[model samples]
Target: EAGVAQSPRYKIIEKRQSVAFWCNPISGHATLYWYQQILGQGPKLLIQFQNNGVVDDSQLPKDRFSAERLKGVDSTLKIQPAKLEDSAVYLCASSLDPHPDRNTEAFFGQGTRLTVV
Candidate 1:
Protein backbone atom coordinates (compact mmCIF):
# COMPACT_ATOMS: atom_id res chain seq x y z
CA GLU A 1 0.00 0.00 0.00
CA ALA A 2 2.97 2.25 0.33
CA GLY A 3 4.50 4.20 -2.48
CA VAL A 4 8.08 4.65 -3.62
CA ALA A 5 10.44 6.45 -1.27
CA GLN A 6 13.35 8.81 -1.97
CA SER A 7 15.80 10.53 0.27
CA PRO A 8 17.19 14.06 0.57
CA ARG A 9 14.37 15.92 -1.06
CA TYR A 10 16.74 18.74 -1.89
CA LYS A 11 20.45 19.12 -2.46
CA ILE A 12 22.83 21.90 -3.39
CA ILE A 13 26.42 21.55 -4.53
CA GLU A 14 29.10 23.42 -6.31
CA LYS A 15 30.05 22.48 -9.80
CA ARG A 16 32.41 19.48 -9.96
CA GLN A 17 31.18 18.08 -6.67
CA SER A 18 29.57 14.67 -6.39
CA VAL A 19 26.05 13.87 -5.36
CA ALA A 20 24.05 10.72 -4.78
CA PHE A 21 20.38 9.95 -4.43
CA TRP A 22 18.53 6.99 -3.01
CA CYS A 23 15.26 5.31 -3.84
CA ASN A 24 13.14 2.47 -2.52
CA PRO A 25 10.52 1.14 -4.84
CA ILE A 26 7.07 0.05 -3.89
CA SER A 27 6.72 -3.48 -2.61
CA GLY A 28 5.94 -6.10 -5.24
CA HIS A 29 7.07 -3.85 -8.06
CA ALA A 30 9.49 -5.47 -10.43
CA THR A 31 10.27 -2.50 -12.66
CA LEU A 32 12.17 0.45 -11.28
CA TYR A 33 13.34 3.55 -13.10
CA TRP A 34 15.45 6.62 -12.55
CA TYR A 35 14.71 9.84 -14.39
CA GLN A 36 16.15 13.32 -14.65
CA GLN A 37 13.99 16.38 -15.10
CA ILE A 38 15.28 19.78 -15.94
CA LEU A 39 12.99 22.71 -15.59
CA GLY A 40 10.47 22.88 -18.43
CA GLN A 41 11.53 19.50 -19.72
CA GLY A 42 9.83 16.16 -19.38
CA PRO A 43 11.41 13.39 -17.38
CA LYS A 44 14.23 11.66 -19.22
CA LEU A 45 14.84 8.03 -18.40
CA LEU A 46 18.32 7.55 -17.04
CA ILE A 47 18.14 3.89 -16.21
CA GLN A 48 15.69 1.06 -15.69
CA PHE A 49 15.90 -2.18 -13.78
CA GLN A 50 13.80 -5.28 -13.67
CA ASN A 51 14.42 -7.26 -10.52
CA ASN A 52 18.03 -6.09 -10.09
CA GLY A 53 18.88 -6.68 -13.73
CA VAL A 54 19.49 -3.70 -15.94
CA VAL A 55 16.84 -3.42 -18.61
CA ASP A 56 17.91 -0.13 -20.12
CA ASP A 57 20.38 2.69 -19.59
CA SER A 58 20.98 4.02 -23.04
CA GLN A 59 20.24 7.56 -22.07
CA LEU A 60 22.36 7.56 -18.98
CA PRO A 61 25.50 9.67 -19.09
CA LYS A 62 28.11 7.06 -18.43
CA ASP A 63 30.82 9.68 -18.14
CA ARG A 64 29.37 11.08 -14.95
CA PHE A 65 26.20 9.30 -13.94
CA SER A 66 25.71 5.85 -12.52
CA ALA A 67 22.89 3.85 -11.00
CA GLU A 68 22.20 0.48 -9.50
CA ARG A 69 19.32 -1.53 -8.16
CA LEU A 70 20.35 -3.69 -5.25
CA LYS A 71 18.67 -7.02 -4.65
CA GLY A 72 15.73 -5.91 -6.77
CA VAL A 73 14.54 -3.53 -4.11
CA ASP A 74 16.44 -0.34 -3.36
CA SER A 75 18.28 1.78 -5.88
CA THR A 76 20.86 4.54 -5.93
CA LEU A 77 21.92 7.13 -8.48
CA LYS A 78 25.14 9.07 -8.43
CA ILE A 79 26.63 11.92 -10.39
CA GLN A 80 30.34 12.60 -10.08
CA PRO A 81 31.99 15.86 -11.03
CA ALA A 82 28.56 17.36 -11.24
CA LYS A 83 28.12 20.08 -13.75
CA LEU A 84 25.82 23.06 -13.77
CA GLU A 85 23.74 21.28 -16.36
CA ASP A 86 23.04 18.59 -13.82
CA SER A 87 20.94 20.93 -11.76
CA ALA A 88 17.58 19.26 -11.95
CA VAL A 89 15.16 17.04 -10.16
CA TYR A 90 15.95 13.36 -9.90
CA LEU A 91 12.88 11.16 -9.87
CA CYS A 92 12.36 7.53 -9.02
CA ALA A 93 9.47 5.45 -10.25
CA SER A 94 8.30 1.89 -10.10
CA SER A 95 5.76 -0.22 -11.90
CA LEU A 96 4.20 -3.48 -10.94
CA ASP A 97 5.33 -5.20 -14.09
CA PRO A 98 8.33 -5.06 -16.40
CA HIS A 99 6.53 -5.36 -19.71
CA PRO A 100 6.05 -1.93 -21.23
CA ASP A 101 2.87 -2.95 -23.01
CA ARG A 102 1.23 -3.81 -19.73
CA ASN A 103 -1.43 -1.39 -18.52
CA THR A 104 0.10 -0.92 -15.11
CA GLU A 105 0.87 2.66 -14.14
CA ALA A 106 4.13 3.72 -12.50
CA PHE A 107 4.22 5.36 -9.10
CA PHE A 108 6.72 8.15 -8.57
CA GLY A 109 8.49 9.28 -5.49
CA GLN A 110 8.99 12.85 -4.34
CA GLY A 111 11.98 13.81 -6.41
CA THR A 112 15.28 15.06 -5.13
CA ARG A 113 15.96 18.53 -6.40
CA LEU A 114 19.64 19.10 -7.05
CA THR A 115 21.09 22.56 -7.44
CA VAL A 116 24.59 22.98 -8.74
CA VAL A 117 26.09 26.33 -8.06
Candidate 2:
Protein backbone atom coordinates (compact mmCIF):
# COMPACT_ATOMS: atom_id res chain seq x y z
CA GLU A 1 0.00 0.00 0.00
CA ALA A 2 1.26 3.43 -0.80
CA GLY A 3 -0.40 4.73 2.35
CA VAL A 4 -2.39 7.87 2.93
CA ALA A 5 -0.52 11.08 2.26
CA GLN A 6 -1.07 14.59 3.61
CA SER A 7 0.63 17.92 3.08
CA PRO A 8 1.59 20.95 5.11
CA ARG A 9 2.85 19.39 8.26
CA TYR A 10 1.95 22.50 10.25
CA LYS A 11 0.17 25.77 9.96
CA ILE A 12 -0.53 28.79 12.15
CA ILE A 13 -3.06 31.47 11.50
CA GLU A 14 -4.96 34.15 13.30
CA LYS A 15 -8.60 33.87 14.21
CA ARG A 16 -11.04 34.31 11.33
CA GLN A 17 -8.39 33.33 8.83
CA SER A 18 -8.53 30.48 6.39
CA VAL A 19 -6.45 27.39 5.69
CA ALA A 20 -6.68 24.28 3.59
CA PHE A 21 -5.14 20.83 3.88
CA TRP A 22 -4.62 18.24 1.19
CA CYS A 23 -4.80 14.46 1.33
CA ASN A 24 -4.02 11.73 -1.12
CA PRO A 25 -5.20 8.28 -0.25
CA ILE A 26 -3.55 5.05 -1.29
CA SER A 27 -4.19 3.74 -4.74
CA GLY A 28 -7.41 1.71 -5.05
CA HIS A 29 -8.76 2.93 -1.75
CA ALA A 30 -12.42 3.71 -2.27
CA THR A 31 -13.09 5.00 1.18
CA LEU A 32 -11.39 8.05 2.59
CA TYR A 33 -11.85 9.75 5.95
CA TRP A 34 -10.98 13.00 7.63
CA TYR A 35 -10.66 13.31 11.35
CA GLN A 36 -9.86 15.95 13.93
CA GLN A 37 -7.99 15.30 17.12
CA ILE A 38 -7.86 17.87 19.83
CA LEU A 39 -5.33 17.81 22.61
CA GLY A 40 -5.90 15.06 25.14
CA GLN A 41 -8.89 13.67 23.26
CA GLY A 42 -9.69 10.94 20.83
CA PRO A 43 -9.96 11.63 17.15
CA LYS A 44 -13.37 12.76 15.97
CA LEU A 45 -14.79 11.84 12.62
CA LEU A 46 -15.35 14.94 10.58
CA ILE A 47 -16.21 13.59 7.17
CA GLN A 48 -15.97 10.53 4.97
CA PHE A 49 -16.28 9.68 1.32
CA GLN A 50 -16.95 6.64 -0.75
CA ASN A 51 -15.43 7.33 -4.12
CA ASN A 52 -16.08 10.92 -5.13
CA GLY A 53 -19.30 11.13 -3.20
CA VAL A 54 -19.66 12.18 0.38
CA VAL A 55 -20.88 9.34 2.55
CA ASP A 56 -21.21 11.27 5.79
CA ASP A 57 -20.42 14.77 6.90
CA SER A 58 -22.86 15.31 9.71
CA GLN A 59 -20.08 15.86 12.18
CA LEU A 60 -18.34 18.40 10.01
CA PRO A 61 -18.82 22.05 10.88
CA LYS A 62 -20.38 23.05 7.58
CA ASP A 63 -20.37 26.74 8.29
CA ARG A 64 -16.65 26.81 8.72
CA PHE A 65 -15.38 23.59 7.18
CA SER A 66 -15.66 22.03 3.74
CA ALA A 67 -14.14 19.02 1.98
CA GLU A 68 -14.13 17.34 -1.38
CA ARG A 69 -12.93 14.22 -3.10
CA LEU A 70 -13.26 15.30 -6.70
CA LYS A 71 -11.91 12.20 -8.41
CA GLY A 72 -12.14 9.57 -5.69
CA VAL A 73 -8.39 9.68 -5.30
CA ASP A 74 -7.44 12.87 -3.55
CA SER A 75 -9.30 15.12 -1.13
CA THR A 76 -9.06 18.52 0.40
CA LEU A 77 -10.36 20.06 3.61
CA LYS A 78 -10.74 23.77 4.02
CA ILE A 79 -11.53 25.79 7.10
CA GLN A 80 -12.66 29.35 6.67
CA PRO A 81 -12.69 32.00 9.32
CA ALA A 82 -10.87 29.66 11.63
CA LYS A 83 -11.34 29.89 15.36
CA LEU A 84 -9.03 29.36 18.27
CA GLU A 85 -10.86 26.23 19.27
CA ASP A 86 -10.10 24.79 15.85
CA SER A 87 -6.50 24.30 16.78
CA ALA A 88 -5.83 20.62 16.50
CA VAL A 89 -4.37 17.89 14.34
CA TYR A 90 -6.23 17.07 11.15
CA LEU A 91 -5.72 13.49 10.09
CA CYS A 92 -6.32 11.80 6.76
CA ALA A 93 -7.00 8.12 6.48
CA SER A 94 -8.07 5.62 3.86
CA SER A 95 -9.60 2.19 3.89
CA LEU A 96 -10.67 -0.42 1.42
CA ASP A 97 -14.29 -0.52 2.51
CA PRO A 98 -15.98 0.42 5.73
CA HIS A 99 -18.57 -2.30 5.80
CA PRO A 100 -20.06 -2.98 9.19
CA ASP A 101 -19.45 -6.69 8.87
CA ARG A 102 -16.04 -6.53 7.30
CA ASN A 103 -13.02 -5.77 9.42
CA THR A 104 -11.29 -3.40 7.05
CA GLU A 105 -7.98 -1.82 7.96
CA ALA A 106 -7.13 1.80 7.51
CA PHE A 107 -3.93 3.72 6.92
CA PHE A 108 -3.33 7.21 8.21
CA GLY A 109 -0.97 10.02 7.40
CA GLN A 110 0.98 11.89 10.00
CA GLY A 111 -1.54 14.74 9.85
CA THR A 112 -1.31 18.51 9.78
CA ARG A 113 -1.14 20.50 12.95
CA LEU A 114 -3.04 23.76 12.89
CA THR A 115 -2.76 26.50 15.43
CA VAL A 116 -5.25 29.30 15.45
CA VAL A 117 -4.54 32.28 17.61
Candidate 3:
Protein backbone atom coordinates (compact mmCIF):
# COMPACT_ATOMS: atom_id res chain seq x y z
CA GLU A 1 0.00 0.00 0.00
CA ALA A 2 1.25 3.47 -0.78
CA GLY A 3 1.89 5.60 2.28
CA VAL A 4 1.33 9.23 2.92
CA ALA A 5 4.23 11.55 2.01
CA GLN A 6 6.08 13.98 4.22
CA SER A 7 8.81 16.41 3.26
CA PRO A 8 12.09 17.34 4.93
CA ARG A 9 12.88 14.06 6.58
CA TYR A 10 14.90 15.94 9.17
CA LYS A 11 15.13 19.46 10.45
CA ILE A 12 17.27 21.24 13.06
CA ILE A 13 16.56 24.70 14.34
CA GLU A 14 17.74 26.82 17.21
CA LYS A 15 15.39 27.40 20.07
CA ARG A 16 12.97 30.25 19.43
CA GLN A 17 13.25 29.86 15.68
CA SER A 18 10.40 28.68 13.49
CA VAL A 19 9.97 25.56 11.40
CA ALA A 20 7.36 24.10 9.09
CA PHE A 21 6.55 20.60 7.91
CA TRP A 22 4.44 19.53 4.96
CA CYS A 23 2.32 16.45 4.37
CA ASN A 24 0.50 14.87 1.48
CA PRO A 25 -2.04 12.34 2.59
CA ILE A 26 -3.07 9.27 0.64
CA SER A 27 -5.58 9.84 -2.08
CA GLY A 28 -9.28 9.67 -1.15
CA HIS A 29 -8.56 9.78 2.57
CA ALA A 30 -10.94 12.20 4.18
CA THR A 31 -9.64 12.39 7.72
CA LEU A 32 -6.16 13.76 8.41
CA TYR A 33 -4.16 13.97 11.59
CA TRP A 34 -0.96 15.51 12.86
CA TYR A 35 1.00 14.23 15.81
CA GLN A 36 4.07 15.12 17.83
CA GLN A 37 6.33 12.42 19.14
CA ILE A 38 8.93 13.57 21.60
CA LEU A 39 11.96 11.48 22.39
CA GLY A 40 11.18 8.41 24.44
CA GLN A 41 7.47 9.17 24.28
CA GLY A 42 4.62 7.94 22.17
CA PRO A 43 3.15 10.08 19.43
CA LYS A 44 0.58 12.55 20.71
CA LEU A 45 -2.21 13.87 18.54
CA LEU A 46 -1.90 17.57 17.88
CA ILE A 47 -4.66 18.20 15.42
CA GLN A 48 -7.14 16.46 13.16
CA PHE A 49 -9.31 17.48 10.24
CA GLN A 50 -12.30 15.95 8.58
CA ASN A 51 -12.00 17.19 5.07
CA ASN A 52 -11.00 20.88 5.35
CA GLY A 53 -12.83 21.41 8.64
CA VAL A 54 -10.94 21.07 11.88
CA VAL A 55 -12.24 18.25 14.01
CA ASP A 56 -9.88 18.70 16.93
CA ASP A 57 -6.91 20.79 17.91
CA SER A 58 -6.99 20.47 21.66
CA GLN A 59 -3.43 19.22 21.97
CA LEU A 60 -1.93 21.72 19.59
CA PRO A 61 -0.18 24.65 21.20
CA LYS A 62 -2.04 27.42 19.49
CA ASP A 63 0.40 30.03 20.70
CA ARG A 64 3.27 28.37 18.87
CA PHE A 65 1.94 25.69 16.62
CA SER A 66 -0.58 26.00 13.84
CA ALA A 67 -1.81 23.63 11.16
CA GLU A 68 -4.22 23.69 8.26
CA ARG A 69 -5.43 21.29 5.60
CA LEU A 70 -5.97 23.10 2.38
CA LYS A 71 -8.90 22.08 0.20
CA GLY A 72 -9.19 18.84 2.14
CA VAL A 73 -5.92 17.57 0.78
CA ASP A 74 -2.37 18.66 1.58
CA SER A 75 -1.52 19.93 5.04
CA THR A 76 1.15 21.97 6.74
CA LEU A 77 2.25 22.35 10.33
CA LYS A 78 4.25 25.31 11.57
CA ILE A 79 5.78 26.10 14.91
CA GLN A 80 7.14 29.53 15.81
CA PRO A 81 9.28 30.48 18.75
CA ALA A 82 9.98 26.83 19.15
CA LYS A 83 11.23 25.52 22.45
CA LEU A 84 13.75 22.79 23.06
CA GLU A 85 10.97 20.65 24.46
CA ASP A 86 9.27 20.83 21.08
CA SER A 87 11.84 18.64 19.41
CA ALA A 88 10.15 15.56 18.02
CA VAL A 89 9.20 13.52 14.98
CA TYR A 90 6.08 15.02 13.51
CA LEU A 91 3.85 12.39 11.97
CA CYS A 92 1.05 12.83 9.47
CA ALA A 93 -1.71 10.26 9.21
CA SER A 94 -4.86 9.85 7.22
CA SER A 95 -7.84 7.55 6.99
CA LEU A 96 -10.89 7.10 4.87
CA ASP A 97 -13.08 7.88 7.85
CA PRO A 98 -12.74 9.36 11.30
CA HIS A 99 -13.25 6.07 13.00
CA PRO A 100 -11.40 2.98 11.92
CA ASP A 101 -13.34 -0.13 11.04
CA ARG A 102 -12.85 -3.35 9.16
CA ASN A 103 -12.81 -1.58 5.84
CA THR A 104 -10.64 1.47 6.51
CA GLU A 105 -7.45 1.92 8.46
CA ALA A 106 -5.17 4.84 9.12
CA PHE A 107 -1.89 5.22 7.27
CA PHE A 108 1.04 7.19 8.60
CA GLY A 109 3.83 9.01 6.91
CA GLN A 110 7.51 8.44 7.64
CA GLY A 111 7.48 11.65 9.67
CA THR A 112 9.71 14.71 9.78
CA ARG A 113 12.19 14.82 12.59
CA LEU A 114 12.60 18.21 14.19
CA THR A 115 15.46 19.12 16.47
CA VAL A 116 15.44 22.27 18.53
CA VAL A 117 18.94 23.22 19.50
Model 1: residues with Cα > 4 Å off, grouped in runs? none
Q: Estimate each model's TM-score.
A: 0.96, 0.96, 0.94
lDDT of 1 by residue, 1-99 (tens): 888999999999999999999999999999999999999999999999989999999999999999988899999999998999999999999999967
Off by over 4 Å in 2: none
Query: Which prediction has more favorable lDDT, 1 or 3?
Result: 1
lDDT of 3 at 35: 92
> Per-residue lDDT of 5-31 in model 3, one digit per residue for the tens?
999999999999999999999999999
Q: Report the C-alpha displacement of residue 36, candidate 2, in angstroms.
A: 0.3
Clashes of each: 0, 0, 0
Put down candidate 2 lDDT per residue, 28-99, tens digits, no spaces.
Answer: 889999999999999999999999999999999999999999978999999998999999999999998888
Better of 2 and 3 by lDDT: 2
